[model samples]
Target: MSILESLELALKNIVSSKTRTVLTMLGIIIGVAAVIVIVGLGNGLEQYVTDSFSDMGTNTLTVTVMSRGSTRTLSVDEMYEIVDENSQYLDLCSPTVTMPGYVKIGSETITSTSVQGVSEDYFSISGDTVASGRGLQYSDMAARGKVCVIGAYLNLAYYGGNAVGQTLRVGGQSLTIVGVLAQTDEDLEEGGSDDCIYLPYTTASRLIGDVSSYIITMQSEDYIDESVAVLESALYEVFASDDYYTVTSMSEMLETMTSMINILVGVLAGIAAISLVVGGIGIMNIMLVSVTERTREIGIRKSLGAKERYIMQQFVIEAACTSALGGIIGILLGDGLSIAASTVVTRLMEETLTVAPTLSAVALAFGISVGIGILFGYLPAKKAAGLNPIDALHYD
Candidate 1:
């Protein structure tokens, strides 16, 4: 029989056994939909993190001392020396020291307040603007000034009315609020930019003791390579080993994150693929039952001069159609679910997340389902084809 005739016969068989066909297709539907949703979410998370870091600017570099290495303390003087030596390549340098403490205003005390001791250049490097009053200045650090800058959350949470110039006891030290940072959508968690307090590094060091790291802001992206080289040389002289210090640029970090995201996506997709395997086994099992039920029909067709290849083709085509139909429906449902999930996440984060399904993912999912149909349908198709017509007819 021709391929068209086989397909027509297969369609008739499928229509006659609608309930069984639907049950067999269920597995394919679930498997394809799962693959699409998993891939969509993985890609969306990667894009979200990439955009977040990209917005922070590529010209910035952070220098940190490794925790395991030598315990030699790095000082404010050493930090300035490195900055001054590479002043031609660098625009600003800020040393930061963070401590866990509480901010007390009479009876109202916010516990575990994030207090960052930073230099005058911190504001410019951080890309945040002062909402009121003035940012820290050279004089403040030089004088070990008893002044502080509160984030947007702190200003609104406790000191909404005339926050600047108000005295708040921080870590048992009386410090005047010199500035209140502008409200920002970024940093939505505790210890984030919008929830922390800033003070001059000198004063913070005096109160909190010791600075751990420094953030170097480059003049432009053009100077990153040269500045990094100069900074690394300086740090090498101080620490004497690559293990003692780490100088990393934002661009490098972005690359690392991209690699990690790709690996994670691959791993997640692999896990979802397991369902497709199970779905294929279901198709095979159903096709075997189908072959047995139609055994007498097969015998009559063969006795009337039907070829084994034609008999096998009809069954194979029928199984493929069932799986392909399921795949199409799964793709549509998966796409809808992916969009809904993205919308919910975007609202909760107050930021846009791209979770749109890619063309490649749709094609891949559909293709896998169809491939499973062909592979699993073959064994039963062959089994029915190999049966002896006389024996099949006599089996009742």
Candidate 2:
């Protein structure tokens, strides 16, 4: 018989035995759905992390001095020298010093207010804009001026729009607010930019007593690795010990995070594969029972000159069709569930989480389902083909 004829015959048999077909397909359906959901969720999590890191910009690099007891620490001047020497790759650099202070407005006292002292390019490199008045200038750092820039939240909460030119006490010293930063989404959260006040790094060092770290914003993302290597060499020349200073780029860190996420997704997908194995076992079990139940039909076909290969082909195709159909339904259901899961996570996390089922994942799940049917159906099909016609005919 032609393959098409065998396929048609298999379809007819499945329709006639609807209950058995559904029971046999149950395992494949659940398995494919589970795999798709697991993989879809993994992809969504990876995307979320990527988006978060992207917000920080990949061209940014941070350098920190590690203090191991007697180990030498990098000075602010050394940090500048490093940037100045590598001016070809670096667009801007800043030494930062941060401390916590109190902001008092009459009887209202907002404690734990962050005070950061940085260079003039701090705002430009950090992607912040000055909303009103003006940002810190070279003169501010040169003279260690007592002027400060305040975040949007600080201005709105305490100064009530009259923040600029107002004197605010930080660490018992009065600082005139020179600028109010543009409102940023990050400002709404605790410890975000909106809750901080900025000062010139020189002035901030005097307040905080030390500047141990610096950030170099790269002019181009393409040279991040080369830039990091150059910076490392320069730091070695300055500090003379690798343990004293560490250099890292946001792009490199992001790449590592992406690799970890991909590994996690693969692991999760493997765990979900257990369900497919179980479904395959179920298919084998059902096919075996089906072979026994159809012994009479097998005998009649054999007596009418049907070949063993034809008998086997029909049964295998039937099993494959059952699994393939189930897999199709499972893909649809899995897509719906994955979308629903994304919605639930978004609501819980207060962030938009997108779950998109990839075509590769869908194809893999469906292909596995069909392949399982063929592999598991083989033994039962061979058994039916090998059965003696006389014995099968004699059996009730």
Weakest 10 consecutive residues of candidate 2 by summed lDDT: 184-193
RMSD of 1: 3.4
Residues 1-396 of candidate 1 have per-residue lDDT tens digits of 888888888788878888887888887888788789888987898888888887676788898864444565466788788888788887788888886668797688877568889999888888889999999999999999999998887777677647898888888998999999887666555556588788998898788767778888887788778988998898887777778788989977887888888798889888878777888888899989988988999999999998999889988988888789889988988998898988898999777886867899999999999999899999999999998999889876
Cα displacement (angstroms), candidate 2, residue 310, comes to 0.9
Off by over 4 Å in 1: 1-4, 55-58, 66-74, 84-90, 186-192, 218-229, 303-305, 343-355, 390-395
Computed on alpha carbons, the lDDT of every model, listed in order, comes to: 0.84, 0.84
Candidate 2 at 374: error in angstroms?
1.3
Model 1 TM-score, 2 decimals = 0.86
lDDT of 2 by residue, 113-221 (tens): 6888899989888888999999999999999999999988888877787788887877777789999999877326555657888889888888777777787898789
Residue 322, model 2, lDDT = 80
lDDT of predicted model 2:
0.84
- Model 2: residues with Cα > 4 Å off, grouped in runs: 66-73, 101-106, 111-114, 186-193
